[model samples]
Target: MFADVRRRPGNYGLGGTFREASAFVNGCDAGNSWGLLIGFREWLALKLGCEANLTWAGLILKLADVDASLHPSGSNLSATEDERAVEVLFAELDEFLSARKGASDVGRILEKYLRQNS
Candidate 1:
């Protein structure tokens, strides 16, 4: 999923390759000081309403949630912030995917996950 985002065009205005986006999503670099993870989360959310899969969207949102909590205002985050956010994000993703392995459409599953998790 991170690789896919990296391959996409325009950098969604966040700059850097999708690898950088991946880093940002993982709470690294913050993507040019623009809160890349938050931006990616918003982009993913919009995509979710359109054509994204539920499982992937849920995962993206989960990452975004971690990034947002670490850098709520989208400011430039530090390596320590990134590291902490990534740690929490992965733990949450593990828990989330483990519980929803049987779900067919992640979009619907994501909606439910957000409702319950939020």
Candidate 2:
């Protein structure tokens, strides 16, 4: 699956072919950073939704929850602050994932509180 994703030159770029995918895998190996994972998951989630795969959607719904939670606050937040916030979230995610294989459960819990209040 990842190999397929890496082949898209427009997205991954023609130059340094292996670097982006390698970085993404290394990032995942570190037990933190889900930019690629989330992006991939989001795509899968959308496809699942189209196919009526409620189970798959349920698996990744937390990403949506977290995005919504932070949306309003980020509207007024500085880029640096948002970057810091993301770093904190990633750190917390790393801890959570390291503690268990069911890291998505942790993601769901965090998502519930990370969204905009209003």
Worst 10 residues of 1 by lDDT: 34-43
- Which regions of candidate 1 deviate over 4 angstroms? 1-75, 104-118
Give me the candidate number with maximum lDDT: 1
lDDT of each candidate versus the true structure: 0.42, 0.37
Question: Model 1, residue 108: displacement in angstroms?
Answer: 8.1
lDDT of 2 by residue, 16-88 (tens): 2222333444455566544323333333343334322332223233332334234442333345544443443
lDDT tens per residue, model 1, 1-118: 4443344525544444322444445554244364323223323444335433333324443444444443433345565554443444444444444544443434555565465445
Model 2 regions more than 4 Å off? 1-73, 102-118
- Model 2 clashing-pair count: 2
Q: What is the lDDT of residue 50 in candidate 1?
A: 42
The positional error of residue 41 in candidate 2, measured at the CA in angstroms, is: 18
Best by TM-score: 1
| Positional deviation of residue 42's Cα in model 2 after best superposition, in angstroms | 22
